[model samples]
Target chain A: MTTRTVTCEPQNFRRVLSSMCTEPHPLARQAASRFLATNPGDPTTYRTVSKLESEVVERLGEVTGQSDVEGYIASGGTEANIQAVRAARDFHDVNDPNVVVPEHAHFSFHKAADVLDVELRTVPLTERLVADVDAVAAATDRDTVLVAGVAGSTEYGRVDPIPKLADLAAAVDAFTHVDAAWGGFYLPFTEYDWNFADAAVDTLTIDPHKLGQAAVPAGGFLTQSRKIMDTLAVETPYLESTSQATLTGTRSGAGVASAVAVLRELWPDGYREQFETSMSDAEWLADALSNRGFDVVEPTLPLVAASVSERLFERLRKRGWRLSRTANGELRIVCMPHVTRELLESFVETIDELR
Target chain B: MTTRTVTCEPQNFRRVLSSMCTEPHPLARQAASRFLATNPGDPTTYRTVSKLESEVVERLGEVTGQSDVEGYIASGGTEANIQAVRAARDFHDVNDPNVVVPEHAHFSFHKAADVLDVELRTVPLTERLVADVDAVAAATDRDTVLVAGVAGSTEYGRVDPIPKLADLAAAVDAFTHVDAAWGGFYLPFTEYDWNFADAAVDTLTIDPHKLGQAAVPAGGFLTQSRKIMDTLAVETPYLESTSQATLTGTRSGAGVASAVAVLRELWPDGYREQFETSMSDAEWLADALSNRGFDVVEPTLPLVAASVSERLFERLRKRGWRLSRTANGELRIVCMPHVTRELLESFVETIDELR
Candidate 1:
């Protein structure tokens, strides 16, 4: 008899969380403890979930200058993109829906389009790695329901020409959705003129977990159009309905509470300070990498994408520095709130020694 | 100057967790306390989520006799059913994929098939209010990839003849999926000879929150086949990957952890005892309603589907009793583990007086 041995080890992601919040503040711990004591159902679960959702939405609204902004919490950026596409498709009532996405857009867009059976038209990127507005304009047809602009492209961490793409989408009377899952939480506080709300885009994706310092499964889609949200609103007699809408049926109230906690703990100054620090660190890292003779893709915002020679890449990996490499031989490094300046400096110093 | 009021009322669901495990069990409360602390993205956060998911899956597995069953924690029964269908379609290589579902099956089947572009063929129910085996056999064609048999159909609460459905599906070489979302957690302990594993069904939907006395947003599709799970495994360089498979990325590890906790606290026998208690209460309520001259559908497994005339439904609603009425004038009273027998008697007695 072959016995199936099941060794219960905590998952890798959980390990990361433990390490990240090693010495949590007393208030944070207390907030969590309070929530656990009261396992209420939806809308009444944790004070934090609903509070945080509204705070984030209001903060986003203030930044975008949109008063009618509505947000729905999602598991991650992928789910956010999926919901956005579904809403756009349903709103346009297109039999064969099409979305204009840049070649460098997040994989979630393609996954969403494939799952929803929407036709995805990819636009080429220019030399500077920004979305080619002309290519996007050319891709548009009567069947096009959405034009997806990237606030932060994964490969090079460069923001797409949202103003140009939004203009094109506007000309064709199609909805523009910005894939801001990586940028939305940061761009609001950045010095860059990337106005998500003002950029003619109707829908935007934001991952609080990525840049807002929230846990995973805390992404959202922010929309200014009430009509678009209503199109995706699923009302069932069995389901507890809320004025707030979501693609999913049951949501984790805990996830919502976590977001609320993060937002409250880090208000206007905290968010702005974190964004400024990220920008400074990103600049310093880019300069250090360039000084060490590596070709760096300077970000339009706070991310630094550098391309190391094949030999150098192998040597760096052997030295134990984990960095993401794109297909075009570019390595991406994000300046997260948790990533300290010393850690960045040490990484650069180690790279210099290897070079 | 106009002042905008931002009401930060944390939703009810998040608060519910605190109340459910408020006292008596320190470990469970401690686990819940730990989950309340961090945001969803914190890797350490899996303790709470994974506990919930694993608990639910293990309990369902014990009932189904498939210990090696892989489970993906989803938002609700709708998402669980959708994910199961998606996996079936992709695994079987069904071009122009279609699913065979009974006419009385839950609406989620139609919604999922619609989203996946899978043609759904509804088989008519027999006079016994169960899926007709002959109708299901006739509905299968070359394009049929999945056949769904309802265990406790929402309207009738009657378990379909799985033995017959399994034989039909085997003859057609299609995957047999059982939508036991409402009954999977209870039917195993009921006086019914329905073993999920013995029935040879490929996938089974179970909602622990529904019958296992857990919170909402905790549902799963348990499967014995690794091939079916692999079909839904989405891989990306940026995403977390483990030996275990999942449909969605960045799952609520806290929810998963809570599920595991629930199962550990309530083993198969414990669950069986709870189910037996609920079943007895259901039977009692059904008898009481019938004795009082109400047209009550017989107690089917875990639920009692009663047909209270339209006048009676309004009267019951006015009395502050929440009961679901079916399209065919049937009212469903789900006897959950938390629902006390005394409460059941009181409700039934009140109905008797009205009748």
Candidate 2:
């Protein structure tokens, strides 16, 4: 939080593709350490860190194409999504409020629906593994307060037709929410129009920890207007600030500071370079798996979901490769910034030997 | 999370009384850094950090005097409190559910009430600033689903009559929750029985960041039964595990590992000694302020709330004292583990000079 600038050279993560090896940029870690004791929930005391929160929003705005973005650095995408839906539900005129989300939307939506006491209308995806815009439109009515679309889905890395979904939500007077938690950082470099500038999104969920190279728990929640944000505000009687919009209080300043450092260091250029390499790796892995006669999904983004046998998946786990499976039981691999071609080669060689 | 043991010498924070000075033990910080990249939300991938989370629950159960406590390392007290109320509301048979809380319960209860769409009935405290048991008994009805009592309230460090509150809630078939987020670690050293072993508390909110000297966001939420916890579980479809009871989907492993380190290093003896020093500091400050003709609330625990002139409060803020005021405009001071006699002496001297 002091004026002492931390110097951290980026480290090469030449290890396994497990989330554990998804190391942050050194400066981001240093910033987290320096601000370890500060609490951003009470913004008055940690004024500088609080200001850094604004800078984080500013950078996030630049990335998401919202010039006047207003939001906080959240614990992760889950909190961001929860708060977004809470805001939408707070202003609903009907007693039985419902939220319509894509089938591939993050499970955080389900958590939000349960905690907020609202009906969750899950619209199934199309054959392309993206949201069925027509189905989403059909599920909406007067009681629908929110309609959510996924920018980059968890299982298959599929991007929904956000512009069409936004129009459907608008016709029903429902706020549009974009779950770009996994794609917000990478989509900026690519030709994806999933952000605010591309659609009428009222709120967006983006994570700095995903591809922004920040420490964990740096999820960004951006709101289009003050009315949307103030809907979530609660009075704080014991602090200098009268109201707080965040879901949690007394949080570590690690995420806020780390997000600022990562955004400052990697905006546009550094991140663009990383995304290129990661995209190539994902494409390469998809092709390599296809050549080996394995059923693989298209890697539109830097993520691969392939149909691997149960025995082979267990063998990969035994080799210390932490892998995840999709809802349909396909092996899911996210080509994060740390995932390299070298690691994928080793994975392929192991598959051949095991098969 | 690896087998390598970390040794951290406890550092003396003789600098300031601001929350920013509330640093964790050095080893706790080291552990946080080591596990920064891991996500505890997906337990199957980060198996070791997830195991450490169980160990954290074990240590927390010992400290809270509940041999079998079921909970997770929450983002902070805010999440723990919200989840506790959600669990209570989930199983309520009544069409309209209400929660009864003491006057000084943390504002997070209000946040929970707003988010969960439940009625909040706040019972005023007695002249001694503790919960009014009679008023709490009168507040509960057939629609009441939860009764919450505060242990070490925010503005004033006062413990509610948990036994009486629990009894009243049980008579009405409502769950009882204790918000010991600020007092859990210190009350074990004191004579307070605000935990499950002392009362029929269905859920307790405690923070390892507050007195356990862990990293920030290391909040402990303990439940009496697996049935109570299961009420809040939501299906995490994409994760390795099927269901997760936590409110958030992805979280840093920093708080989880740091809590384990702090609990392991200071559980019975180190924290006991620290409590002795902190309690004395609170009492000493109360005496010093009273002798100076300032009206001071009794520092029952290690927190003091005193009446000071508006000009004096502003001057202290100008002097870089990160102070907080109560709802009634009284200055509140929390003698965290970082607060020493010397720092209190400096604060008192500054107050005298400014006056």
True contacts kept of each: 0.26, 0.64
For each candidate, the alpha-carbon lDDT, in order, equals 0.64, 0.85
Chain B TM-score in each of the candidates: 0.84, 0.95
Compute the lDDT of residue B203 as modeled in candidate 1. 85
Cand 1, B chain, TM: 0.84
DockQ of each: 0.27, 0.42
Residues A161-253, candidate 2, lDDT per residue (tens digit)?
889999998998989999998888889887777999999999999999888888887888999889987899999887788899999888768
Which candidate's lDDT is highest?
Answer: 2
Query: What fraction of the genuine interface contacts, i.e. the true contacts, does candidate 2 reproduce?
Result: 0.64
lDDT of 2 by residue, B199-303 (tens): 999999999988888887688889979998789899877677889999887876888888888788788899999889999999999999999999999999999
Candidate 1 at residue A3, lDDT?
18
Candidate 1 chain A lowest-lDDT run of ten: A14-23
